[model samples]
Target: IKPPSTESVAVLQQVPIKPLTKPLTYPSLVSVVEFISFGRRKQLYAKCPTIRKLEERLPYHLERVEIETIGPGYIILKFDNFSVGPIGAYRNEISMWCPGKRVTRSTNLSLYEATEKFALYNLSRPGTTIKTLETKYTPKCILNCIPLTIENYVVDGNDRDKWIIRTTRPVKTLQTDFIIRHDTIKYAKEVTVTRPSHLPIRIHTDILSEWNCESITIERELTHVEVVDYCRKVSKRTDRPIRSVFKSGLGGYSTELFQMLSRELNAKKMELEGFFGNLIQCATIYINESTELSVLMMEPEIWIEVSTTPPSTVLQPIKPLTKPLTYPSLVSVVEFISFGRRKQLYAKCPTIRKLEERLPYHLERVEIRTRGSDYIILKFDNFSIGNFGSNNESNGKIAMWCSGKRVERSTGQSLHEATEKFALYNLSRPVTTIKALKTNRVLANETLIFLDTPKCILNCIPLTIENLIVTDFIIHTDILSEWNCGCITIEEELSYMEVVDYCRRVSKRDRPNRSVLKSGLSGYSTVLFKILSRELNARKIRMTVFGGNVLEFANIPINETTELDVLMIKPGVLKIKVCARRTAIDRAF
Candidate 1:
């Protein structure tokens, strides 16, 4: 007689859910994701054999319900959206089921109910249509225009009225040539994709027909539950009673559950001790957290195989730098810019031209000397090997002199070295060099000091070096220490229109005399004075301030031929005043 076939058992569980703050509405869909775990039962688990309907209305309202089998012990359930027809027109129920063994201990752990909202623009797909609406009940607003199909229906029929009210609520809208795209939901039967079994199987194929082994015994101790179950199964088959023998002082299983386990373990032990011990074999081993402590003491060796060949390397082309390359000795004085890649340095002065002429040379070494509190002296020496005076047996002599002083002495080096050294040292001198120079007339003429504040000294460069120097002149005075004290940190609200009108008045006068405006005084006088001072400096005119608001202007011409000195107070209050010069081809106001 044939052995009795195994019977699949059905397990029904009522999943618990908190009542919604408000009943779910559509075109909203319900999604149920359930994770069911199976207990230790020696049975080959398969896909849920039957689809158990839990709750229903008239016809099947559930669509797209799905189940996925996890790693031998778990199964996942995903319910379908409630889109059968117009959301409020019909009624449907949430129902679902999955297969499990009679000895299986299933749970509704991690079961969630989520309401999904669909786009209003997504109409019903071809072949699938919504049920005809009853004459007594009619949808309002945009819902009236929606096609009767599962894809178009979103909210549930019982809750559609509320959802319609919310959708029709007044909101600001703007007309535009723009449309937003959204994902469309189709009214189709739930799709089922075939998947491979997660159950671990071991096949023994030899000279005879192949047979499968159902269990895998790892190199670790079994628990009491496992021991009892093993003994019960063995007793039923062999009709023998055996007691567990503990291997250690601790009360535990004395030996492995199966003989193959011992043989397999011994084989691994020998392999680890054999010549091929380094050979890698890949595998995934499963164990419980509580068994982790025991597994650690056993010192199991598991191999995780990796790719023997290295990954391919990709070669990328290197890009050329945008700026010109410079040596450590060369300073980035000026960048020659053009439309694309062309480079050109426009030498507008004699000093700049001299430096540009020596651009192709390399320097041996250079030094900087602070002359008084204003001037900087660049000492260029080229006495080193492979330079100008190196081949000549002549002892290096003073090549140049400034103000009867021994300026540059070449120690048997090339002119190239001396020239390059001079150019680089001038460009890259430290700020300390500028600070060491005293604030005197010579310094004021030789260096352009870009001062944003009393404490903040921006740059100190040679007046002749047009690249970085600011085109502004200075008047020297030993006293007047608190000129910048209480200076406005923020922009002063001096009337811009007043400044403009003042510029116009100055430009209109045939010979403007000393003028003063006391009422409209504002801060930012330092910045404003700089603008006016810059204009006077460009014209080589001098201004002297004694006390009070008295300003003495020197060498200002009324016309083309005649010249006279005049004084004025409260100069235009911005850098733009320099651009609005009183004497220009066009009106500057």
Candidate 2:
């Protein structure tokens, strides 16, 4: 395999979750382009109730924000008591932007006070930071911004015409639903205003124009490859490692991407616009994930940038609107990388669980080798195929590896047979006989017996066999009444004490007067009893010489008009008792 494309390779692992304890650092202004595109308007919406509430309470002081938690749908931000003295005497107030809380302010009388208070108390101490947005609005913002910037970059062979529109609205925002729409794009076509609204006065270009600020228009266009290359450079400035993100297949500027970007921007105390979400969406879809952005760059007059609105709205010889830039492919490279070797193995191995279960110990490794046309040898580690002797090292030696051991066997033989022989060999003299054991059973000519191990109750022999052919004696797991010496038959072994104890336990656990034994218990005990008694006041069962024990039969249920009969032919010689009932069981002679 050519090692699959880089796009198909998923991130081998995610960075372990460690708390980012350091105070947030701000990125340079030149790095802002990585977070937002100059080609379009930008916005981000935060729906987390905590974020929305914090938006109302938090005052911005032109300081970087930091995250306390970042997982799934939850995020928290940490802040300290505010001081604005160090910022400078001229700068009385500073503004910081975040989702939902669009603008936050910190105020100080002098530079000394601002700078002294500028160091937040919580930045290095125990605190909270909302690292991610918990809302539906952010994803929508990401989706919608793509089209607004589509005209700036050519897609495939299509070129865009017409001058862009610049709208400046009032700075004083009212608590009303402000919805905006664009006709061309598929995603993020509309944006609904948030509740307890705070509109950014700075972005209200009309209000900002009245200030002493100078108007500057910077326009430039780059090829698709150039844009991707530029993103690589910008990633360093943004501290996002944008190239790796694309290679790992999380390239699309989806809501998730925007969320990450917002976290970075927050940590850096960077300004963010509503359409930055869209700008990221466009960069992720066009430049990063696809070659179309590069293809667009190859054509002339494709890459266009006019950051500041020109003095004359009608100054340019504008071309008519051509066909809109359409992104035909939305499949993200992230998908391809996420399905890695683990997923490939999952697709191949349907019975992997069964294979794991068959191992005697925790399987450290497995080597599958093809033998003949149809056969395969699976050699597994972390288990021993045979018993270890005094001379052998403790490292789970195989039977063949154990020199001069009593249970030495050929490794080439069937694993099941070898294991069975070894187990039987070990149980020879001092070990308790199977007849004396209560919970163990002998299988396959006494070669293998049930042995209790520390980790599990049912431990398999060192070998696995499927469909072993039986040459003698049929084994029956059901209840049996008779024993034949000539043909060996097997069932759950029953003893006198077992029968007594089972009934006693059931009586104590269930309704003692009328208890019902299941079929499994009946099979295990090899006897089904229906006991009847007329003594309502008798707490203990009345026993007869013929009955095995009073306690065992006492718990066994019997009906009204039922009789228990015990047959004794001679002294100390007893036969089975037959119980008869009018509506229950028939009498047996």
TM-score of each: 0.15, 0.16
Whole-model lDDT, model 2: 0.25
lDDT of 1: 0.25
Span of 10 residues, lowest total lDDT, candidate 1:
207-216
Tell me the tens digit of each residue's lDDT in model 1 across 1-589. 8754444222223445567897444223212211112111101123322222211111222233222332332233333321212212212222222343122222232211111111122222222222211111112322333333332122222212222212111112111111111111111111111112452222111200110111112222234344333323322232111111111011232222222222222111111222211211121111221110011111122111111111232234689878755643233343221101111232234444544443332222233333333223333222211222232333543244322332334554444444434444343433312211112122233233433211112233322221111112232221111122211111233443344334334433443222212123354444434443454431333333222233333233335533322222233222221112343212211
How much is 164 displaced in model 1, in angstroms? 40
Local error of candidate 2 at residue 55 (angstroms): 29
Instruction: Give me the displacement of residue 535 in model 2, in angstroms.
Output: 29
Which tens-of-lDDT digit does each residue in 35-96 have in candidate 2? 33211111211333433332323222222222222233222332322222212223555433
